[model samples]
Target: MTETVRIATLDGADSFDAYVAWPEGTPRAAIIVIQEIFGVNPGIRAKCDKWAAAGYLAVAPDLFWRIERGIELDPDVEPEMQRAFELFGLNKPDDNVKDIEATIHWIRREAGVPKVGAVGYCLGGKLAYMTATRTDIDASVGYYGVMIDQMLGESHAIAKPLLLHVPTADHFVDAEAQAKMHEGLDGHPRVTIHDYEGLDHGFATESGNRRDEAGAQLADSRTAEFFAANL
Candidate 1:
């Protein structure tokens, strides 16, 4: 079952609504499902429900609320993509982390679960890495996170379990950039990197021309196992 709820921000001056899914009986852990450049749309809400079906108390926060509440954009549309990027640029990493932290706090208090984990895609994927290093979450899974090569310096800060799913053909991250990420992050004791060959960015979205059902299933199953063991 699922419902809409508001999580208080750090300053308490603002609150954002999130779609929360609850498993039957008590939850084994809490999973925070971060969104792509799009807001908390049907896809992200479906992800929260999927996690809940896996026995987790899951929530997907509307990270775009501060900029434009309830915005849902189609990935294939050029105008929507441009607008998404514009809104994405308006956010700083620190502010995004604060909202994620607020979501974690809400889960810890409301779910009555001791463990929390995070899974994010696209823009949310980068945020998942930040969540692992900057927050107290038990585990994190990032699916083809953009700009990770730029943030490789923080890989050493991760003390908890982390899984990064990389698609070899992703336009956002090319071969040279992937090499940099491999050099900086692969074989780190706490990090697990999975590379998907012949796949593009947002392969897990199950929509448009980018969707790869096999790849998405493989990555998501790995994520479920990761959260199951770590969270």
Candidate 2:
């Protein structure tokens, strides 16, 4: 089951709307699932449910709550894509990090989990990387994050285990950016980067046409392994 919950931030703002899901027993770990530019839609909700079933206290927050609540995109439509870009472009990465931080705090305290992990996709993937650097999460996984190159310069400060899943044919993130990410992660003992060939962005979203079952399975296996090892 899921419940809408509110969380307070370091900036003295009450600005997060989150969907919290827990397993039948005490959670072994907690996870903060961040959303894509499409907001907290069915795909993200499914991810939260999946994590909870995997024995985690999973929570997915509507990161766009600062701008609008429940603003989701129809991935099959170009107009909806354009509108999503327009709305998301109005917010900066810092704003997204604040919301993520608030969600993390709630997961650790209110969710009653001893340790926490995070997983994100697309824009949420970038936020996952930022969350690792800026928060005290035990582990973080980012899938096809477009802004990874932009954040590479700050990766040295990351102290937790970070797993990045890249699609070889992603339109938004190219080969050169993947090379930059590798270089940024160089010598970081806790960082693992994997590239799946013939996969595109949104490979794990079952509702999207780009979803590749094989790629998503591999990513999910690797992500679970990473979280098991780290969290």
Candidate 3:
């Protein structure tokens, strides 16, 4: 089951319209699922439900709520991509961090789970990195995160366990950039980076044409293992 909820931001504003999903009994952990540029669409919500089914209390906050409420995108459309980018371009990374922090606080306070972890996709993957830096999450998983190199420059602030899933063929993230990200995280013993071959951005979403069944299965298995180990 799922319910729409609101969370208060650090700046004393209503920051998100989020969905909470869990079973009837107590949860093992609370998970914060961040959305891609498309906002909190059906795919992300499904992911939250999957986590809930796996015995977690899952919450997916609408990160793009600052720009517009209930904005959703068709993953295959160029126009929708443009609109999503336009909305995301309006906010700075610091703003996203604040919003994410607020979401974390909401989960910790309201979800009633003793431990918390995070998972994110696309733009959310970057936010997962940011969440590790700013929040007290036990674990985090990022799927096909862009701008990881930019986040690596501040790796000193990250201390939690992080799993970054990258696609070999993703245009936004090339081999050289991935190498830099690995090098920057050299001393971070808690970080694990995995590269999935023959996959592109949004490979975990079944609705996307580039979705690779094998790669998605491997990633999902590893992600669940990572959370189990850390959370």
Candidate 4:
């Protein structure tokens, strides 16, 4: 079943809503689903539900709550995309990491799940990578993260398993950036990188015209296996 819950931030200065889904019985693990620039929309919620059906306790925190709660934006809408970017700019990377840290704390306080990990898409993808280098999560998966090349310096800080899904054709991550990322993370024992040859940015987003269903399925299956093994 799925429900909405309020969780406090690291400083407890404010609380944000997180869409949560639970497995039939006790969860084998817990997964934090970070949102794209679109916020906690249907896609993010569906991801949580799918994870729950797979026997993990899943939660997607409202990262955009500090700007506006319950934000559901369409990528095709220029104004909405603009708003998403505006909010993105205002929320520092450190802030996002703190919210995720608080989420980890909240989950540990409220649930008895054996392990916790995270999976993120688009903007959340970068957050997931940051989570790996900064937080205490067991594992993390990032789907075509942006500006990850710049953060590769922290790759050595990753003590937990990390999986990265990169679409070769993604405009946000050009060949140069991808090459840099691969150079930094490819041979690391704890890191796994998968590249889809011709997929575009947001290719895993079910609603986008650029979505590559087959690729998404394959990446998702790999993610499931990675989480099952590491978490």
Model 2: how far is 113 from its true place, Å? 1.0
lDDT of each: 0.89, 0.85, 0.83, 0.91
Candidate 1, residue 63: the lDDT equals 89
Q: Tell me how far the alpha carbon of residue 56 in candidate 4 is from the true structure, in angstroms, after superposition.
A: 0.7
Candidate 1's residue-wise lDDT over 157-218, tens digit each?
89999999999999999999899989988879999999999999999984676789999999
Query: Candidate 4's residue-wise lDDT over 1-231, tens digit each?
Result: 889999999888889889999999989999999999989988888889999999999989988877788999888788988988887887777878899998898888887665899999989999999999999999999999999999989998999999999999998889999999999998998999999998988888866665788998999999999998998
Q: Model 3: which residue pairs collide?
A: none
Instruction: Kindly give the stretch of ten consecutive residues in candidate 4 with the minimal lDDT sum.
Output: 203-212
lDDT of 3 by residue, 1-231 (tens): 899998888877555688889866888888888888888888888899999999999988877776788888876889998888887788566777787778777877766676889999888888899888887788899899889898786677778899999898888788888788878875688788888876788888746775788889999999999999888
Q: Give the per-residue lDDT of model 2 (tens digit) for 1-231.
A: 677787776686466678888787888899899898888888888898988898988998888877887787877789988988887787678888887887777776777677989999999899999998998888999999887888877787799999999998999898898888888886688888998988889998857777888889999999999998888
Ranking by TM-score: 4, 1, 2, 3
Better of 1 and 3 by TM-score: 1
Error of 2 at 104 (Å): 1.3
TM-score per prediction, in order, is 0.96, 0.96, 0.95, 0.96
| Residue 94, candidate 1: C-alpha displacement in angstroms | 1.6
Order by lDDT, highest first: 4, 1, 2, 3
Badly placed stretches (over 4 Å) of model 3 are none
